[model samples]
Target: MRVLIWILLILALAIGVSLLVGNNEGYVLIVRPPYRLELSLNLLLILVVLAFASLHLLLRFIHYARDLPANVRAYKENRRIRLGHASLLEALHALSQGRYQIAQKSASKALDLGEDPSLTALIAARASHKLKQKGQRDYYLAEAERLAPDAEVARLLLQAELLLDDRLYSQALDVLQQIEKIEHRFIPALRLELKVQLRLNNWEQVLVLLQQLEKHDGMESWQAREIRLQAHQHLIERHGHNLNTLMNYWKRVPAEDKLNTRIAKLAADAFIRLNAGNQAQEVLEMSLTREWDSELAAKLGDCASTNPQKQLQQAEHWLLSHEQDAKLLLALGKMCMRLELWGKAQSYLEASISVQPCAEAHLTLARLLDNRGETDAANRHYRLSVQACEDNK
Candidate 1:
């Protein structure tokens, strides 16, 4: 539409100029030294317009010619950038698909083409690691660090993760420490450090990391609970040989964690092993008061408190609520035996056997019968104990 409009305007102007020129009686004369020239004014005007148009076209052509080399360079540079971007995309897709070799090849190509050098190198590093090519992986990681010196945290994080996968825990921990020096509270780095600590059996560090992860919501509640339980159990065992150390450690344990049955059982057993029966009893009571566990109840009997009657009272109190619990019955029987209430012990043991028939209850009952000179009954109970153990297996 614009071209048609321009063409009509040009025709209209030409007709107007022709009518004016045909009516005009004008002329232009040029003289120079020995030569003179004369031309009609309409023709002179046409020559002048054509001369201006030709000069504009010639200058435009010259300018285009002058810039042609730079334009070619720019086009080549743009094409390289586009191809590098495509290669980077291919590398990312192949990596996600687990085609490690292809990912490595494409990432290397992108790196050579200078497409975000640090990212490309890191991709190649991960691919090499997946293929178990440690040397090449290290090379790429070094190149990544060298190419992007400001990305220390990213480089160190990847290094730590790869070292962890290799089971090089100490080295991984060193790398994580480097990251911590730069950004102390990084969540993903903290999570990786937790695994490293756990593998290295640094139980104290494991506990610390668990707290950090819990605070940051970096771990599931149930997962943190399990790891925390394991860490506390190990710490308790580590201090078990010294009664004062064990008790001190127990005192520092969080109140909610002390209520966990498994952790409570461990602390109780550790205290009992160290002959700190009062501490064991305290731990068991605290745990059982929060929630009754049959295993913890059974462990309660093992605490040889100075006051046997008091321990027996505690077990009997638990019996009011857990009457059908076989382990609790066995524990009550053991407690009763400690207090020399033979009749009560016998009754509780028999009740435990009737309920579940475990080896410990049968064996304890046999010992009690043997003490009373009931040889035939003791032998029968002993056989039953052996049979129960075999059935359990």
Candidate 2:
């Protein structure tokens, strides 16, 4: 339909032109002193239109010719970019597959092709590290640092993680600390720092890291508890001989944490070591009242309070609730013996043996009997204690 309309329009324009030419006596005249030139008006109009079209085409050709070298360069650059992208993908794949040498080569090519050189440099660094090419790894890492100074934190994090994997704990710890200085709230850095501290046996630092990690909910309750327990145990050992420091540290520990059976036992033992038996008794009694623990009750027997009657009463009271608990009976027996209540001591010790038959109860009973001039019975109890010990082993 368009072709038909154009053909009709052309015929109409031809007739119009013809009519105009026949009806007009228009002409173009160029005159000089010795020459004159003339052309029909229609011809001049056609020539003017043709001259403008030719000029536009000539300028277009000249423009293309002038830009030919630049255009070729752009095309080559585009090709290189495409190749670089492919190389990057290939490098990533090889790295994942553990083909370190191939990954490094491809990543290097990607960088040379200018495919986000900074990123490619980092990839190459990882590949080099995996290949155990320390020199190459350092070189690539340096290049990455130079190419993108803004990514210093990221590079440092990678460096720290790599050191951690290699078990270079001290180096990793230094890097991790650097990360903490740079971005205090970064979760990954906090997590890594905790691991490094633990490995280095920096118990105090581990405890500090654990507190920070808890704010982020970085660990499960059980995991946090386990780590906290380990840190406390180590710190307790460090202050073992220094009674003042150990008690001071325990005072600072959260009250709720004091309820943990192991920590409570540790504190009680430390108090006993310092001859602060009353203090030891207080810690053990507080924990036992909150929750019954056989181990803590056994540790309860070790507290050497000045008033044996009071300690005995406390054990007997616990027995009312935790009836048939052999450790409590053993503790009550020991407290009675301290006060020279031989009959009650003998009865409690015998009852403890009937309940649990542990070596401690047997040994305590033997000592009570020996002190009361019942040598034969004491010897029998002593033999029983030795037998129990062997049986346990």
How accurate locally, in lDDT, is each candidate? 0.92, 0.87
Residues 1-393 of candidate 1: C-alpha lDDT, one tens digit per residue = 999999999999989988998998899999997999999998898899999999999999999999999999999999999999999999999999999999999999999988997799999999999999999999999999889888888889999999999999989988998988899789999999999989999998898889998998999999999899889878987998998888788788889988899999999889888888888999999999998788988987788899988888878888998899999999888888888989999999999999998888999999999999999999999999999999989
* Steric clashes per prediction: 0, 0
Residue pairs of candidate 2 with colliding backbone atoms: none
Best by TM-score: 1
List, residue by residue over 68-100, the lDDT tens digit for candidate 2: 999999999999999999999999999999998
Worst 10 residues of 2 by lDDT: 299-308
